[model samples]
Each structure stands twice: as C-alpha cells, then as structure tokens.
Target: MPKHISLISLLVVCSLWNMPQAVHAQALIPHTLQLDAENLERQGLQLAQEAAQLGQFQQFDLALPRARLASQLAPNNDRVWFLLGGLHLQAQDVDAAMAALEKANSLNPENPDIFFALGSANFQQQKYQAAADHYKQGLKLKPDYREGLFDLGNAYYMLGRLPEAIAQYNKSFSQDQKFWPAINNIGLIKYEQGDIESAMKQWRTSVEIDKQAAEPLLALAVAMYNQGDRQQALSMGEAAIRIDQRYANLDFLKENLWGERLLSDTKIFLELPRIQAALQQSDN
Candidate 1:
C-alpha cells in the first residue's frame, strides 16, 4: 500500500512549494513621460500616473476616465496610448484596447514591451494567430524577452501546436527559470504527451517554486491521483482548495476524487518482469 498522507500535510507542502515571482517586470514599465514641452507633458504624465495607480488597484472604472483624459491631453504620446489601451483591457473592451494598443505600437514600433502588450490583448480576444504574429515580432525586436516568449508559447498552445508551445515555453524558462507559468505549461504539455511520471515531476517542480499557484497544484494532484496515489492526490486536491476555494473546475476535481474514484483504481499492470526491470533501470 502507498503511504497515507493527511490532507493538511499535502496542503501545507503544496502551499510551501509554490511561491510567486518578484515584481521586477512591473517595475520595468515607465510610470512617467518626459517630453520636451514640460508643462503640458507633465500634466498629462501626472494624470497617466494616477490612472496607473487606479489600474494597479483594480479600479478599472475609475482608471479609464483618467486614462482617456491623459490620452486626449497627449494624443501623440505613446505612453498615454499604452495606458489607455491597458485601461480598456482592464474594462474588457477588447476592440478599444486593440485600437489604442495599435496606435501605441505605431508610435513606438521599436518598443518590444508595447508589442508584447498588444499581443496579450490579441490573445485575450482569442486572436491566436495575430497574437502569435505580434509576439514573434516583439521577440525579433527584443530577443530573450521572457514575457513575449511566454505569450507566444500560449498562442501556440491555443492553436494545438504542442511541440511549438513547448519549445517557446522552454526558451522563456531558460531566460527566467523561476517563471511558474512556463513550468506549469511545460508540465501540461508533458501530461498531454502521456509521459505521466515526467509530467508529475514538472508539476512538482512548479509547486516547489510557488505553492500558492493553484493551477500547478491542482494539476499535480490530478496527475498523482491518475497514477494510483489516492492519499497524495487527496492531499494535493485539498491543498488546491485551500489556496483558492473559488478556483475554476474545483467541482470537477472533487467529483473525480469522491464520486468517480477514477484515479484510485488506474491499473499498473505490466506484461513482463523485464518491462518492470526496464522501468526500474530507467529510474536508476
């Protein structure tokens, strides 16, 4: 029989394993514009800063008005356009965000960050092909741009090009090893490829990196359960619930664990002792 671990231990381990990345990326964004025309630019810049603060606090409704005013005040400023685009995105106004981001990209074509943001907006709108194109363009402008590479990986994943997605994710992870999303995505691809043990290892690594991240924890639990580790699975599942009880598809996971018992009885039958021997050999 497998070891019987408590749900609490599982939760604690999972939580402790997954940690969030630092806010370095957010710091890279320009909070103020410095145009030669000092007064008008400063006024617009101040409004843009206020809008950014609002957006940061998830006050999208409040942010949009200020962002629009700033854009109106500094119509030619790429930063203003970018802020407006971000506000529109927060409001879930995809069309407006796209228009504003396009203008921003046009104004600052060399700025890979703007292109990455535009690609993200496109991805959110289900424009995977266009998102991929924009991400590729952004990468060309700024090689080793981890965000652009990650978004490109997601675009490829959405398009069902798992191998390409995996490749892009690998590239992104190489640049920023602590990026949890890329690690989780790679585990997902591995799981889909029927490499259960490898997938489990990757998911475990993700959880080790950031236990608070619900996605990888849930995925790891599912993988462990599928491999006939009921107690471990239950623990992981419970940990996921603890992290975010409102996480999407929680019901589905619960149903599988309690109602279906789909994971508990997955057969581990082998045809020959040599096959088992080979498996043990590979483990070694």
Candidate 2:
C-alpha cells in the first residue's frame, strides 16, 4: 500500500515585520518594489505553513484553500506548488494533484519528493507502470529513500512484476530492519507464487518485528489454517481481529495487496464459524 501523504516543509515561514530594512537607500523605486514582492513571497510561505499545519491535523478542507492561495501568491516557489499538490491528493482530486505536482516538478526538477507525490497520484489512478516509472525517477535522485522504495515495490506488485517488486521490498527493508510492512508484502508475493511455507515464514518475521501489526498476524493465521492447524489459527485470527477489525474485510485485504490465491484462502478462513464469531465479538 502507498504511504499516507506527508506534509512538505521546504520553505521556512517568513514575516515582513521581522525583516530588517535597509539603513542606506539604494535606487528607492526599484528597492521598494522588490521589498513588496519579497513581502508577498513571505506571506505566501506563511500561508503554506498554515496549510501544512492544518494538514497535519487532517483538516484538508481548510488546508486546500490556503494551499491554493499559497501557490497563487508564490507562483515561482516550487514548495508552494508541491503543497498544493499534496492538498489536492488529500482531496482525492488526482488530476488536480498531477497538475500541481507537474508544476512543482517543472519549477524544481531536482526535488525527489515531487516525483514521489506524482508516483502516488499515478498509483491511485491504477496506472501501475507510470507509478513505477515515477518512483524510479525519484529513487534515482534519492536511492535510499525507504518509503519511495516501498511504494515502488507496491507498484511493481500491482503490475505483476514479482521479482522487481521483491527487489524493491528488499531494498526498503535493508534501509530499516524495523519496517515490517516490507516484510509483510514479501509474504504477499510469496503466497501468490504458491510458496505457502515461505509466505508463512515472511509473515512470521513481520509479526516478530511488530507484534501489533494486524495484517501479518491475520495472514499468518490464514496460512496456518490452510495447513490444517485450525485451533491455533482460530486463536491467532481472533487476536488479529481484536487488534484491528478491518483485516476481517476481504476487500480491505485486497486493497492491502493480498493476491487472489491468498485472498481465496483468507475468505475461507474468515468464513469459519469461529472466525465469524470473533468478528461479531470485535464489532461489540
């Protein structure tokens, strides 16, 4: 799955009130005009900061207008355009997001985060190839960016390029051993490839890394159930559901990248009387 949109902080907030005026005047007209433009830019930065702060609080409705105004006021600042793009993404306006992000990329092609954002936009549109290409471009600029690597892996998985997906997942995991999502996704790919035992091992490792991770826990439960370890699987599945009930939904599992084979097994496991009862109990 793609990571949530993170608020960008490329520009620092500036206030005209805190700026020191020139003690000795140069060419008065041009200098005064330049100061006005500078003040507008500073105000734009301030607005952008406010939008980002609101976004951190999940106030996208309020953030969007401020981000839009920020871009209008700071048309030359890539940071403002990037912020606007992020807000558009939050609003689920993928086309608008792409437009703003492309503007930002045009303004500052060296910034990898814009490419990452573009990759996310494409991923949401189900344009897997485009998403992977954008991620590759961003990774070229910042090869060790763990989240970018993970997202690229997801795109590759969606495209059915399993080997490339696994490579990206491994790269992401190498960046931080504690990132269990990468491990969990490896399990997903393994299960899809009919290597049930390998898939179970990967899920086990993911659970070991983060015991509270519901996805891997439930996946392990399903694998164990498929292997005829019904009693223990039921116990584990119950625990996983209690930790997070969303995993009980097959659609949610599919959204999380569970392939058809694993999903078929998961559906059967979820339909078991014990698991169904557990789901009911969790709902209570």
Give the TM-score of each candidate.
0.73, 0.87
CA lDDT, every model vs. true structure? 0.72, 0.89
Q: For candidate 1, lDDT tens digit of each residue in 1-284?
A: 01212533454455456634324323322221223235555677889999999999999988888888788667789999998998888788989999999999889898887888888888887888999998998999998988889889988988988889889989998998799888777877676667767777877888888879877786776667666786766666666656764433435433322112222221121222432353344445
- Alpha carbon lDDT of residue 113, candidate 2? 100
In terms of lDDT, model 1 sits at 0.72
Report the C-alpha lDDT of model 2 over 177-260, residue by residue, as the tens digit: 999999899999999889999999999999999999999999999999989998999999999999999999989998898899
Provide the lowest-lDDT 10-residue window in model 2: 1-10
Off by over 4 Å in 2: 1-32
Per-model root-mean-square deviation over C-alphas:
21.5, 9.0
In candidate 1, clashing pairs total 7
Given candidate 1, what's the lDDT at residue 269? 18
